[model samples]
Structure formats: C-alpha cells, structure tokens
Target: MKKTTLATLSLAMLGATGAAHAQNSVTLYGIVDTGLTFIHNDGGNGNSYSMSSGNMSGNRFGLKGTEDLGGGLKTIFVLENGFNSTNGKLGQGSRMFGRQAYIGLTGDTWGTVTAGRQYDPLVDLVQPVQGDNWLGGIFSTPGDIDNADNSARVNNSIKYTSPVWAGFQFEGMYSLGGVAGATGSGQSYAGAASYSFGQMNLAAGYYHLSNGNTLAARLAGTTTWDSLFNTSVNAAYQSASSINNARIGGNYTFGPVTAGGYYSYAEYTADGRSLFTRAQKYNTGSVYAMWQVSAPLQAEAGYTYMHSTGNSSAKYNQFALAADYLLSKRTDVYAQVAYALASGTEDPAGGQAQAVIGSATGDSGSNKQALVTVGIRHKF
Candidate 1:
C-alpha cells in the first residue's frame, strides 16, 4: 500500500507542476459507496450479515484533465484509484491507479487514441444499456461469468474510439504482451459499436484474451486478466489457453418506463496446460424493466438465466428487484434483493453451486441463495 501511495503522490506533483497553462484544467472526483448486506447461504453453509463497500458501485477517486492544443487537438489524461471504504485498503491488487491510468490525444476530425490500463470496448459501449448499470452487480450475470459486473481490465493497452456520427460510434482495443521474443503471447483484444435512434439504443461487442502461460509460446507477462477465474463459478477453467466472449444488447424507452436486455456467449478453450479436456462454454441472457413511479424515485425488476456446456453441464436462474431514490444530483440511496437457484454438475476444480450476489467469497452449499442490500452513494 505504501508503494501505491508514493506512486500517487509523484503523479499528483507532476500534474500540479503543469497546471499553469491557461487552456489546461484538472479536476478531482470520487465516489464513496457503502451499505449493509444480508445473505442467506453465504459459502453455501451459513447465513451472515455484514457492512459492505461498493455493493452498488465501486469506491474510487480520480484526477482527470484536458489541455487544448492548437488546431483542434487536445491532450487528455485520467488517473483513477479504487479503494475499499470498509478497510481503507486499496482495490485492484493495491495499485495506485488501479481503476484507470491513461493519456491520449483527441482531434476534431480524427478519432481518439489512448494508451495504458483501461476497460475494454464491451464494457465501455455495451454495458450502459444493461441492468447492472442501473442497480449494480445484484442485477448482473451469474458469477459475472460474462463480465457484466466490470471485474476485468486490460493492462498495457491501446484503445481507439471514433466520434459519434448520426448517433453511431465504434471502438477497438489491444493489449500488448511484453514478453521478449513473443509478440502474440498473452495478448488481449476487443472491438465494439453502438447506435442510438431516438429513445432506442443498441450495441454489440467481442473480446478475446489469452491466458498468461510461458509453456505455450513464451511468457508474455504484459496482459493481466485480474484472476476473474478465482471464484467458485468458473474456477475449473483457470488453466484454459484462451477466453472469448460475444455480447449484444439493446434498450428502448416508452413514456416513463425503460426496457433493456443483453445476451452473452463465452467460451473457454483449453491447451496442454488446461485442467479440462474439452472447451467449456457459458450462455447467459438477461432483461430488465425500470419504471419511474415519481420524480425522485424509480423501481426495477430483472431476470437472468445461465447455462453451461462442454466441460460441465449446469444451470442457474436468478431474479432481482431494486428501488432507487435520488437525494440530489450527486447522491442516491438504493435497496435491492437477488435470489438464485442452481443445479447441475461442477467444474471439477470449482466448488458446489455458489452465488455472487455482492461478493465473490464462495458459493452456496445448497442449490439456492439469496442476497439483500441497502446502500447510499455520493459522488463529487
């Protein structure tokens, strides 16, 4: 943690020294999210109640700035850090700028390009229309198997995004593998696009990631997947050679109600180092409807179903409900409940049927689990 603090201080000092330009501006911003949560069947054996952090949204602080250069060009940067309000410890492996750290250039006619650690195209363009964006991970995919909870990040990445035209925009990203004599090892890449027409929105994207393994080609240690497979849901696929995901989503607004849904298909392909003999696959579907009952209050209901094939056969059914009240433009309070039922075979290395309502601790020992939480979020 001390190492992260020093890195943060150095970056802040450097930014402060360059804040004298008239056309440059830097702003500090953050979100503090905390809540009380109750779980029926945590780790599949016992019920628990605890104070939690970032159940609705991640707790984070960040510095972002833009400097206008001549000829309609600008320099932009963002340095964001994630933390846990409960323990005052760092998130995302205790990196100083774990959430994001990037510098880039934008132009009037050309597209934008950024380099550093960042979210992939699917998370950037396809997630906004998803239910998780409205009520957080409680409304997300099971085990976040499809990354609907935004748990993955790409390091050593370069991203490009085009300006919106006729309400259409597209993006692409690539993360390099910094191993010597191995250009393609441990690489990750993605592409996505979105279009808006009146009150309707649609998006699609694909992501591919190669596991970091030196025995295959060579050790390309640049790309780090954050160990998303370290959970009970998809643990057996940890030794897979590669992971691929394809997603599509759309949303429509009618009067005071908004409806949306998304579909995702993810495949885990094995290599010689894999645990399973064949490829493992997951198919997930989700939909939600949000109603604006009043000016300051809104409610939502959602449903999700997931199925597994190949290495193991499994099934999961989830239902969720939520309500949000706005205290101010930058503050909100929310309450949500999620219930899940699972049945099927295990992933060998994975645990019994488990759930990830608000935490990734472990799975429910039985075939069912429920989670309830209420929280407050403030942004500045």
Candidate 2:
C-alpha cells in the first residue's frame, strides 16, 4: 500500500509539472546566408575573389520565448546572434548577440513593447518596399550612405509598436544617453509609419541621433555613439555632433511583377570640434522592378542616384541586377551583379569619388566599380 501511494503521488507531481510547462514555450530559429563573390576593383587594386556571408538576410541564430499570462497578454523575449559563416567571426563589432537582443510584453490589442539594443523604426518599416528587400544588398544604396542596408543599430533603447488598423501601422523608439551630467547627449530617437491599400504599400520614417561631446567626455560608464560611418564615402562625417535622416518609399504590385521607388535625405551637423564648419548633406533616390519568372525563379533590376553637398560636392550612379532560384522552402541559390560610377569635385582634390558598391570592402580604382556574387542561403 505504501509503495502504491508513493507511485501515485509521483505521477501527480509529474502531471502538474507538465501543465506548468505547457503554459510557457521557447523556440529556436536562424538563417545562414553565404556566398562566393568577385569584385572588379579590390581596395583600388585588381580583381579578387572570396567567400562572403549574409549576402541576402544576415546570418543569424536566435531564441524566442513566450510565457502566456491570462487575458490575451504574454511576456516575450528574444536573443539573436549574428556571424560570418565564411570563417566564423562574430558581427556587429564582435559582440555576442549582436543582431538583436530584447525582452518585452505583448498584448493582442496593444501590440508589442520591447527594450534593448534594436534597429530603428526606419529599418523596420521603410526598407521592405525596395528591390533590396527581395534581392539583398546588391541593390543597396551606393556606400549604404543612408542606411538603406541597415548598417547601424541603436543601443539602450525602448520601442513601441501599434497594431494595424485600417491598413496602417506605426512604431517609435528612443535610446537613453546613460550619462550622469548630460541628459540628451548620446541619445537617439526614431519613428515610422506604413500603410497598405489593395496591392500597394507606402512607408515613411525619420531618425535622429546626437553624439556625446566625446566618448570619454561624458562619464566613465555611459553609452556613446558607435559612429556608423566606416565606409569610404562618408567617413569624414563620423565626428559630427548629430545625424538625421528622412525617407519615404512606396511599392505597387501587378500580377507577377512589382515596381517600387524611394527617396532619402540625410544630414550630418557639426560643432566646434568637427572636421568641417557646416552641415554635410546627402540626397539619394532609387527605383526598382522585380519579375517572378516562375514559381521558383525571380529576376530583379534597380537604379540608384546619390548627390552630396555642404562639405563636398559629388554624385554617384549605380545599377544592379539579380536572379534567384528556390532550391527548397528554406534554401535558395542566387546570382547578382552591381556597378557604380562616381563623378564630381571636392576641394583638396578629394578627386573624382570612387565607386564603392554595397558593403564590398573595396573601392574602384577609377570612377567605376563592379562586383558579382554567387551565393547559397539556408534558413531554419
């Protein structure tokens, strides 16, 4: 009798544990996108070839969890990591969980609110309307000057999103300065909204960030701007006191083909300690079209134009083409080509600017640049 009672009690305890486990769940997901690429101009030298990662969607793995609370609300969390698949290097400044790391609560009616290092509203809302949305960085802005390629992220942030109502959705984000004496220094804010009607979609967004006086000027343990201008095109603006960008984009679908376009304006303002006296500004515009050739194949083409003023006067014209085949639901093979031509003049013989396509670590020897990449991508 004693043995039977013990067995029954153990079974009841196991049943209660199972019930608690069922109320909460966690999932693992990731994508691996890698490819071999060829560039006509490598750091202004000759042609070169190498293996690349994150050719389409960035290579990443993440865990997402949710605990159901009563009344249509749940606590959710996500921890994501990004890496280079070629040699296995961590991305986003070599930080662990660099792609995304956040925890939040969700409501069926109130939408989601998350706090952590995260992408701004523009990257989340406005980027999906362009060819790069489907073709990847091959169609990205020349030099990614306006972050059309999502080159930067905000740290120490709080974000709020609203549910779609009447085909419209919106979101906002703010990052703290984390400085003791300065409340506004090293702070950033962004907002975006999107609308969809029928087969057409439109989006607009703006982002603003102010840098601390100096990385060390603020405090011993405080957040500072990471400075996103690592490219050859806009490196000079890294010392600016503030940066702002405004963008608008729209897309329309017709049967198996889709057409889209966008415009962006960005300004980098300086103070007494900056390299230049005035604010530097850039204007970028692009248009693209995609054709679904078949159930498993697609082709896309895009054109981009960029102009700069203030500290320098330069212009860039770029074009890209891509074709992709779906090998399976979670795997695909793709080929793409991109080229850029730069012209104009800047004092001190800034020389005719050289073309630097997408995130390629090379610059054209002359006014023209070209690159070709063949890649495979898998997701799980």
Candidate 3:
C-alpha cells in the first residue's frame, strides 16, 4: 500500500508540473496603411498615380509571446512579417518574417539578449522621431540613409540591449555571415547609444557591412530605362562594394510643438578594380517642425538636401509639407506634397534634367518631379 500511494503521488506531481509549464500566452497584432500617390514631372510626362502601402507606417502582422520563469527572468519570442496592403502580397521579397523574427531571454536588471534575424542598432536608437517614422514615408531621409527604416536588418544576428540607467542606454549587434569557408567575410556590425532628458532626446549610431559584393553586383546588373533617365547614371554606377553609415539626431519639445533635425553620411566604393572603381560619398541633412493646431489636427513641414560627390558630382534639394487629422486614437488621415530638383549633372544619355533617383529617364532636359499622396493609417 505504501508503494502504490507513492506512485500515485508521483503521477499527480507530474500533471501539476505540466500544467504550470504551459501557463504562457501569445498575441497577434498588426497595422494596415494604404493610399493613392500622384507624381508630376516637367517633361510633359504629365502626372501618374498609383496605389501604395506603408505610407505612414509599414503594414505588418506579428505574433509575440512571453513565458514567465519563476524568478525575474522570462522567455520571449516575436515573429513579424511585412506585407503590401493593395494586393496582400508578402513584402521584402517574400521572406516569411522579413520585418523581424527573434527569441530572447530577459531579466529585470541586466538586459535582454536575442538571436535571429533582427534590426541593427541604428534603427532602434535613431528612427523613432525621424520623418519616416513620425511624419510620413514620402520624405524618407534619402532611402533612409541612416538605416532608420530598418533597411539594414541583419540575418543570423545576436543582439544585446542594456538596461536604462539615468535615462541612458546602449545596444550592440553582430551578424554572422553564415559562410562556411569564410565565416567573417559576409558579417556586419553596428552599435548605438541614446539618452533622454525631460522633453529632449538624442542618439548616435554607426554601421558597417563587410562583404556586400553580392548585393552590389545584383544591384548593378539590374537595369531599366527608368533608372537611366531619372538618376542621370546607369545602374552599374549605383552599385557599391561596401557601405559605412553614421548619424546623429535629436528632438526637443515644448508644450504643443516640437522640432528636430538629423545629418547622415554614406560612403560607397566600387566592388572591384573595374573601370568604375571610384568611391562615392553621399551627404544628407534635414530639419523639421511640427505643431498641434487643435485636438485632432496637426501640421508638419520639412526640407532636405543631398550632395553626391565622386565620379559624378550631383546635387538634390527637396521640400515637403504634410498634415494629419486624427479620427480616433488608432486611426488617422493625412496628405503630403513634396518637390525635388536635381542639378549639376545630366541624364545618362547626356540630357540635363532633374528627376527622382528611381524614376529617372534618359531625357534630361532639366527635369523636375513633384509628388502628392493622401492616405489613411490604422494601428492595432
């Protein structure tokens, strides 16, 4: 009888442990944003309109969960995917979790360590108040020059974020290239720091990519007529061996108004000693101010300037204005307009023009491009 009772108790304990182990939860959340965009150019191309997504914020769905582990530690996981709102197609070239996918352990005092495909520190520390994240995407900082849009998500990465101390924190990330023979060949590294004081915030970050040869070659080989016309250069010239980006930015708020600015620099070198083996440097800067006109209405305006120097010396200047009306806490409507001019260079076919980088045509003829977009964004 004693032996039988002992066995029964063991079974009950096993059942209780199993139940406790399963006491965790997961949640699904997402945002969907879309709208119409219109572009006008001086070449009598008139105006073109199209559907777009993530104008205000990227459209995405994510699954996240956390499990409590008795003490002050917890296990967490997140899987997020970006998608197009128009056709419901996967974004980021069909990657399942193109936006983010990671698992980590957290402690109350130490910090968190995560491993997986994840964003670099640049975006985490610098993008929160930038135009791309706060105002709209139309005026993104030169293809998010500082990687503020998380443009440089690292694969096979390990990242650590430190606990905040006196309103200051630090972050670091390293990506394993996953190349068997050349372990460090394709790797990347990034670091950042930030601080907050009252209504003011500041951050600085740096990023470097080692073996971007493949990425550069791919970008160079893909050529289209539009690229030649708008950018004043062939696709080959747009490719770079590796990239180094650095940025510093901050914002200050007083009552119902806020103002901020940032400067970013990118250095691009050719992949090999080809005839186009010349290094190019791109410098960009922007500033803006925003005001809450009323309970539900707000207005923002900004300007940006870019300079490209090297084999081709070109200049680009842009101005933008936008307004937002909050319909509810989770939904808002907005409209934006921007004008850009390109000079000091000619189209690939030797015509002088001003055109947006992605929409350039061979017919230079002093080109000018303007854009207007109206959209609605909803978050959950």
Candidate 4:
C-alpha cells in the first residue's frame, strides 16, 4: 500500500506540472525570399542583382504568445520584425518592429481588439485582390497608389475586428498622433468591410490623414530637383495633410482561374492655399486574370491605368505579365515584366532622362520604363 501511494503522488505532481506549462505558450515563425531585378529607363539602363524582403510576403521573424485567462478570454501578444533576406539587414527604414507589434485580448463573442503598430482594416480587407499581392512586389503599381490593402501602415493605431456573421465582417482603426495639444495632427484613420461567400469575395474601404505640414516644409526646403519633380513632392505632401481615399474590389474564382479588378480614388488638399490649394485628385483602375496551366505551373497578367489631376494633369498606363512554376508546395520560381508610359509634360524625357519623379528611379519621365524580375521564394 505504501509503494502504491508514493507512485500516485509522483504521478499527480507530473500532471500538475504539465498543466502549468500548457497555460502559457509561445511560437516562432518567419519567411526568407530573394531574387534578381533589372530595370530599363531613359535616365540609365543597367542589370542589377538585388535581394528583397517580402517579395511575395514580407520576410519576417516574430514571436507570438498567449496566456489563457479562463472563461473564454485570452491575452495575446506579437512582436514581428522585417529583414532583407539577401543582406540580413533591417527593413522599413531600419525600424526594428517595422512589420508589426501588437498586444490584445480575445473573447469568443466580442471579437478582438489590438493596440500598437498594426495593419489597418483596408489592408486586411482589400489587398488580397491586388495584383501586387498576387504577383509579388516587383511589378506592383508605384507606391501601391491605391493603398488598397493599406500598403502603408499607420503608427500609434488601435484596431478592432468583428466576429464574422453570415460570411460578413467589418473592422475599424484610429491612429493617435500622440502629439499633445494637436489632437488631429499626424493622425490617421481608416475603416473597411468585407464579405465572402463560396468562391466570391468583395471589400470596400476608406482612409484619411491630417497634419502633414512637416512634409510640405521639407519639400519646399529642398532644391536639388527641378520644379516639375519638386511640384510632385509638394502635391504629395499637401495631399497627406488633408486626404481621402476609397476603393472597392472583388474577385471570383472558377475552377483554376480567377479574375478581378479594383477602382480607387484619392484627393489631397493643401495645408494652405497656393498653387497646391486645389484638391489634387488621383484615380486608378486595374483588372487582372490568372490561371493554373498545370499542376505546378501558373500564368497571370494585369493592366493598370492612372490619371492625376489638380495642380498638374499627368496620365500613366502600365501593363504587366508574369509566370510561376511551383518546385514544391513551399517553393516557387517566377518571372515578371512590366512597362509604363506617361503622357503630357510629365512624359519621360526619351532616353535622355534617367529617372521619373514618381517612377522607380526618380529620373526624368521622358522615356518608357520597364522592369524584369526573376526570383525564387520559399515560405516557412
């Protein structure tokens, strides 16, 4: 009897220890991707080898943990950082947590609320339909002009996501400026909603920002670039201070083929009336189709058109095509090429202009621009 009692006691202690460990959990995850990219333009022509992070998805290392608090409630946290896979350096201007960092709580009925630098609802709801996300980063539109998926993250944000109902859900976010006495300065806000049913999905979103006077000041201070390009900077800065953007996008899948398009519009108002007083408007439209030719081979193509009006009127049209072959479930080889042309005074200066202001290289916009990229990506 004594021996049996001792064994039972030891077993009970082991069970208690296991329970303690289960209450707290942590996980590590990341991805690594690299490729070669080549660009041809009027300013200069060269073939360069480069490695980039987040080609298909941003390369990142992260730690996530959860502590069960009982009664369907849990405390969770995530700290993620982006890095270049080729050179192993920090991304997003060297910010340590450039990708994401947030802490939050989850409840079964109430949904989740998270704080810190996190993606806005627009990115969550709309980016999936963008070719940029589908084709990787190389051939994406300039600066993801649409901000379709909130390609640009807002700082000091608090976000709330709702539980799904009938395959529909919504989210909202507010980025606190964190600047005292200036309640609206440097702050950004966004909201978005999405619905998914079977193979069809749809989303719409809006974003607004305020108090970007500093950006304008910096542009005015710089004289290295000419007026044409300088004005572009001024226009962009002014728009940031008082800007609005809206988008609607959706995709439908039929067997191995999917087709979709998105429309986006943006308006920027200057801080004070000047040449920049008139609200600058940017409208963009894009459509794309993709098909899986074989079990491991796929092809995709897309086109995007943009028109900027207000301080100046510039027209841009771009076309892109890409192909990919899966080496394995987690690895793929791909190639993509894109061409862009501009009309009006904003045109590339033939081969004489090296970079276009808004173009990838910041050279003159007098000539056509092209980019070809071939790369390999692996996910983990």
Candidate 5:
C-alpha cells in the first residue's frame, strides 16, 4: 500500500507540472534572404555584380515567448539576432542579439511597456505605411536620412505602446545614455501615432537624438552615436552633434491597388568640432503605388525626390520598380530595379553630387546610378 501511494503521488505531481507548463508558450522564427545584385558605376568602378544578402529583408532568427499570469496579464520577451547570409557573419556590429532584445508585460485593460534595445517609435508606427514596407530600402529616402530603412536602433530604451482604441494607436520611446552625471547626453527619443479607418491609414512621427558634446562621441565607430551616414549622400554631415527628423505619411487601399505618399524633414546640427559649420537640412518626398496582380503576385512603382540645403545645395531624384511572386505561404522571389540622378555640389570634395541608389550600393562617382537585384526570401 505504501509503494502504490508513493507512485500515485509522483504521477499527480507530474500532471500538475505539465498543466502549468501548458500555460506558457514559446515560438522560434527566422527569415533568410539572399540575392544577386548588379550596380552601375559602383564607387567609380563601372558595372559590378555580386552576391548580396538581405536585399528584400535582413536575415534574422528570433525567439519569442509569453507566460500567462492569470487575470488577463502576461509576461512577454523577445530575442532577435541579425546576420549576413552571404558571408555567414553576424550583423548589427556582431552583437549576439543585435536586431532586438526586450522584455515586458501586457494587460487587457492597460497598454504594453517594454525595456531594452529597440527600434524608435517612428520606425514602429510610420514605416508601416511607407513604400519601403513592400519594396525594402530601395524605395526609401536617398540615404535613409530619416531612418526609413531602420538603420539606427536605440540602446537601453524604454517604450510604451497603447492599445488600439477606435482604430487609433500610439507609441513613445526614450533611450538612456547611461552616462554618469550627464542625463541628456547621447540620449534619443521618439513618438508616433497611427490611425486606420476603413481602407485608409495615416501615420506621423518625430525623432531626435543627441551625439554628446565631445567629437569622439559623435564619430561613427562609437557606441554613443553610431552614425548611419555610411553612404556618400549624407556622409559629409557625419560630424553633426544632433539630429532631428519629422515625417508624415498616409495610404489608401481601393480594390486590388494601394497608393501612398510621405514627406520628411531632417536636420543635422553642427558644433565647433563638426566638419561643416552650418546646420544641414534635408527634405524628402516620396509616392508609390502597389498592385496585387493576383493572389500570388504583386508589383510596385515608386518615386522619391530629396533636396538638401545649408551645407550644400543638391537634389536627388530616384525611380524604383519591383515585383514579387509568392511560391508558397512562407517563400517568395522578387526582382527590383532603381535609378538615381543627382545634381548640384554636395560632395565635400567640391565636385558635383554623386548618385547612390540607396544604402545598398556604393557611390556612383558621377551624377547617375542604377541598381538591379533578384532575390529569394524564406521564412521559418
């Protein structure tokens, strides 16, 4: 009798543990995107072809989980890592969980709050209604001056997302510099809101960041600023001490077609240690149309215009077209082409502006540039 009772107790304990485990859920997800790319006039070397990674979307693997805590509240966490599929190397400066890492709690009646490395509010809200949602960075601003490509991610951030109410939602974020004695130095903040009514959607946001007072703090290789001006389009303003960006966008869907446009203004503030003494301002406008040709096929066409003043007077015009075909629910193939033309003197070299299709290709070394890519993407 004693032996039988002990076995029964063990079985009951195992059953209780299993029931508790069932209340928690975890998921592993990843995407692999690779492509063959061709660029005309790449860094003055005419006609270059190479295998590229992340033409459509960055390659990444992530784990997300939620634990039910009763009372309609849950604890959530996510760890995402980015990599280069072509070279089999880590991306986002080789951090283990470079893309995102956050933990927080959510409730039915209240909003969600998370803390850790994260994308700013503008990228979380406004980018969804922009052309880059379908065609990737090739459809973004010339150099992604306003972070349309999500080139910059904030570290040590605390974010709040409001639950949707009456088809409207909002998000706000602030990143801590972690500097002792200086609370505002190297800080970043953003706020954004979006509304959806029927087939129409609208979004707007603002972002600001301080690069610290020292020259070394604003340089590219550091953790404080991590400049996104890798391309020639805005490299001349890399020494800026602060950056401010404001953007607005909206889109409408009618039957199988969707159309949208966006405008952004970005300003780079200069200081005594900067390369340029005057503040640089950039204005960008873009419009796009996407067509769902069939259940499995889609096409998009977009145009962008960017003008810069203050440091130099320049203009950039870019045209892009792309098509994607879904082979399965989790697999797709795509082709994209873009051409860019630049005018006026924007180069610190005192020469005419060089066209760069997007952040993907190198400087054209001239006034015109073009890019073409055919890629495959798979999600698991």
Candidate 6:
C-alpha cells in the first residue's frame, strides 16, 4: 500500500510538470524572396540585368518563443536573421541575428518592454500605413534617406510598446550611445503612435540619430545605427553630426480597394567638424492604391515626389506599379516596375542628382532610371 501511494504521488508530480511545460511555446518562421531584375542605365552600364534578392520582403528566418508567467504576464524573445536568397550570403553586415534580436516581458495591464537590436518606433507604428508595406522598397523614398524602407536599424536599444486600447497603439525606443566621455554621442531615439477606426487608419512618428562627434566614427558609421547611407541621395551628408526625420501617413479601405499616402521630412545637420556648413534637407511625399483583384491576385500603383533644399535644390519624381499572384497560402509570384526622373542641381560633393529608384537599384548616371523585377516569395 505504501509503495502504491508513492508511485501515484510521483505520477501526479510528473503530470504537473508536463502541464507547466505546455504553457511555454516556441515557433520557427521565415520568408524567402528572390527574383530577376533589369535596370535601365545602371551605373552607365546601359540596360543591366541580374539576380536580385528581397524584392518584396527580405529573406529571413526567425525564432520566437513565450513563457507564460501567469496573471496575464509573459516573457518573450525573438531572434531573426536576414540573408540574400540569391547568393546565400548573410545580410545586415553578416550579423547572425541582424534583422532583430530582443527579449522582453509583457502583461495584459502594463504593456511590454524589450531590449536589443531592433527597429525604431516609426517602423513599428508608421510603416504599416505606407505603400512600402505592400510593394517594398521599390515604392519607398528615393534613397530611403528618411528610412522609409527600414534600411537602418538601431543597436543596444530598449523599446516600450503599449497595448491597443480603443483602436489606438503607441511605441517608443532609445538606443544607447555607449560612448565613455560623451553620453549623447551616437545616440538614437524615436516615438510613434497609430489609430484605427472602422476602415481608416492613421500613423505618425519622429526619429533622431546623432552621428557622433568623431570624424572616424562618422566615416565608419556609428555602431548605434546599422546602415545610415545607402545611396547618393544622402551619402554626402554621412559626415553630418546628426539626422532628424518626421513622418505622417494614413490609409482608407473600402470594399476590395485601399488607398494611402505618406509625407516625410529629413535633415542632416552639420557641425563644426563637418565638410558642409549647412544642413541638407529632403522632403518626400508618396501616394498609393491597391486593388484586390481576386483571392489570389492583387495589384498596386504608387507615385513619389522628393525635393531637396537647404544645401541643394534637387528634385525627384517616381512612378511605380506592381502585381502579385498567390500560388498558395505561403507562396506568391510578383512583378514590379519603377521609373524615376531627376532634375535641378546637386551639391558638388554629391555630384549631379542622379535618379535612383528607392535603394534597391543603382544610380542611372544620368537624369532618369528605370527598373523591373519578377520575383517569387515563400513564407514558412
């Protein structure tokens, strides 16, 4: 009888442990996107074609998990890696989890907090209302100078996100400078908010990053900012002391159609140590519409206008169109085309303002550039 009781108690304890373990969960997910691309007047090459990766979404794999802590609280973590599907090369400077790596805690009443390398608040709150959300970088700003395409990520960052209440949500983030002497050098911070009611959604945000006071840091780029300058649109301002960006966007959906637009203003400020004395500013605006032609077919069209002031008076006009056909729930094929025209004059350091379609294609080396891509994407 004693042995029987002991065995029964042991079984009960084992069952309790198993039940506890059931409350924790982990998931593996990823997206693979690859394509063939053609560029008109690519870097003076004249009609260039090549294999491209990440036409609509970056290739990535991620692990996410959560542990139930009870009382409506939980602990969560995510590790995401970005890569090039065409060459099997690691993306985001070859970091193992370059896309995102964060850990945090959340509760039903209090909200959530996380710390690590992650996207800014603007990307979290504002990007969803923009054209880039559907068509990717091809529909974004010319050089992505304002990070409208999420080309830049913050490191050593802590972020807080509030739970949705009454169709409203908000997020904020701050990155540590990690400079011993100067506390503010190389720092970044952002905040954003969104509201949705019925068929309409709106969002706005502001971001700021300090380039650090050292010339070497500016040349090599700051550790706090992953990729600040990717194209000629803002390459000349890499030596600036700081960058500031503000954006606002909204979208409305009716039946099978949705339309939205966004406006952004970015400025690179010069300090005493920089080459240019005045700030370089960019003003960009874009509008887009999407049609759900069918359950498996969708189409999108957009236009972008960018103007540069402060140090230069360059202008850019772009038109883009895209279509996607779904093969399955997790797979799709897509085609996109974009054309850009450049005008006005650029600073000597920046050379003549050449047309660059988003940040994906190379400069035209002339007044105009065009690009087309046919790609396939799979999610798992």
Most accurate candidate by lDDT: 6
Off by over 4 Å in 6: 1-22, 348-350
In model 5, the runs with Cα more than 4 Å from the true position are 1-22, 220-226, 347-349
Off by over 4 Å in 4: 1-22, 42-54, 213-240, 273-275, 345-366
Candidate 2 per-residue C-alpha lDDT over 1-380 given as tens digits, one digit per residue, 9 for 90 to 100 = 00111111122334555534225666778888888988887776778889988887899888777777657888888788989999899988898988788899989999999999788899899998976888887677777767877877778999999999999999999999887787888888899999999999999999888866673432221333345665667766666777889999999999999999899999988788666677888899999999999999999999888888987888988899999999988889999898888887432236567787765444566677888889998878
TM-score for each prediction?
0.91, 0.91, 0.84, 0.82, 0.93, 0.94
What lDDT score is found at residue 305 in candidate 4? 77
Candidate 1 residue-wise lDDT, 36-109, digit = tens: 98888887458989988988789999988877765789899999999999899999989999999999999988
- Candidate 3 lDDT over 176-269, as tens digits, reads 7665575655577889899999999898888776543355433543210001111343233445555577888888999998888778886656
Question: In terms of TM-score, how similar is model 6 to the real structure?
Answer: 0.94
Candidate 5, residues 87-184: lDDT per residue as tens digits? 98999889899999999999887989999888888888899998988867888988777787788788889999999999999999988887788788
Give me candidate 4's TM-score against the actual structure. Answer: 0.82
Sorting all predicted structures by lDDT, with the top scorer first, yields 6, 5, 1, 2, 3, 4
Better of 2 and 6 by TM-score: 6
Checking candidate 3 for backbone clashes, the offending pairs are 229-360, 229-361, 229-362, 230-360, 230-361, 352-364, 352-365, 352-366, 353-367, 354-367
What does candidate 4's lDDT look like per residue over 1-380, in tens digits?
00111111122334555643235566766666676766665334343445444555677777777767667888888888889887889975587987788999987888889998788787788777666557654334444544543345666788899899898989999888665675665677889999999999899998786644466533452211111222222224333346677988888999999888778887766654323446767787878888888999988888877777765666767788889898987788888777777664321221121223122333323446677777787765
Largest TM-score belongs to which candidate?
6
What clash count does candidate 6 reach? 0
Better of 1 and 5 by TM-score: 5
Residue 44, model 3: Cα distance from true site in angstroms: 9.7
